[model samples]
Target: MSKKGKEKEEETMTFKLETAPFDPRFPNTNQTKYCYQSYIDFHRCRRIRGEKYEPCNYFKKVFTSMCPNAWVEKWNDQIENGTFPGRI
Candidate 1:
């Protein structure tokens, strides 16, 4: 449990994020693609900016706008566990 707790706070700087508007281009109205892409972008941003979360703030808004808190939390866990399906 203690180990898990520390992992929860773990941070990595190995990705990038795009400031341009996110566009999935699919006809589906659901924001799944947008959220996933945002996830990727967020990490990309972190990679460039380092472990500090401030530099990746914009991507946070992009994902939070299209995805629910629960989904984001779950995906974040997947990312730390090396199970995220998206490229980062």
Candidate 2:
């Protein structure tokens, strides 16, 4: 492969994937509440701190890793339509 192509591959490979760390609040094997809380916290953070706030991404990453894709999509739609059950 060309040097440029190798460099591009290396750049993509540099990313590190991780799941949400263990939290004392949710010690059981079931992480549903943890995932949901992260989702709520992410939106709340965004609402209070604005979309550009970097810390908000931490919650986003946690929820995205822990919640199922369909759940995330439904929650996103609910938030858009002002139907989300959780307070933000």
Candidate 3:
């Protein structure tokens, strides 16, 4: 019973998502980002802070606060290639 009020607050970041431009190939309108937005935002903020932080295991969860598709894609690709540990 005492544990209920003692839950910890985890720090998190927000990502702003951009709608995909109209493309003739895909007529159906849709909201899409090259990479997960949450990853970009959290990673950027964490890196800027520059200190030991609890590592986030999940990096592919999409959020509406991502920076930009291009930016996120660049980092995501690099991570997949093993250029970096992982995205935020």
Using TM-score as the measure, the top candidate is 2
Off by over 4 Å in 2: 1-15
How high is the CA lDDT of each candidate model?
0.77, 0.96, 0.48
The count of backbone overlaps in candidate 2 is 0
Better of 1 and 2 by lDDT: 2
Q: How do the residues 4-83 of candidate 1 rate in per-residue lDDT, one tens digit apiece?
A: 77677664534675443647573476767777777788889898878687969777778877777899899889999999
lDDT of 1: 0.77
Tell me each candidate's TM-score.
0.59, 0.83, 0.27
| lDDT-best of 1 and 3 | 1
lDDT of 2 by residue, 38-70 (tens): 999998999999999999999999999999999
Clashing pairs in 1: 14-47, 15-44, 15-47, 16-44, 16-45, 17-45
Candidates ranked, most accurate by lDDT first = 2, 1, 3
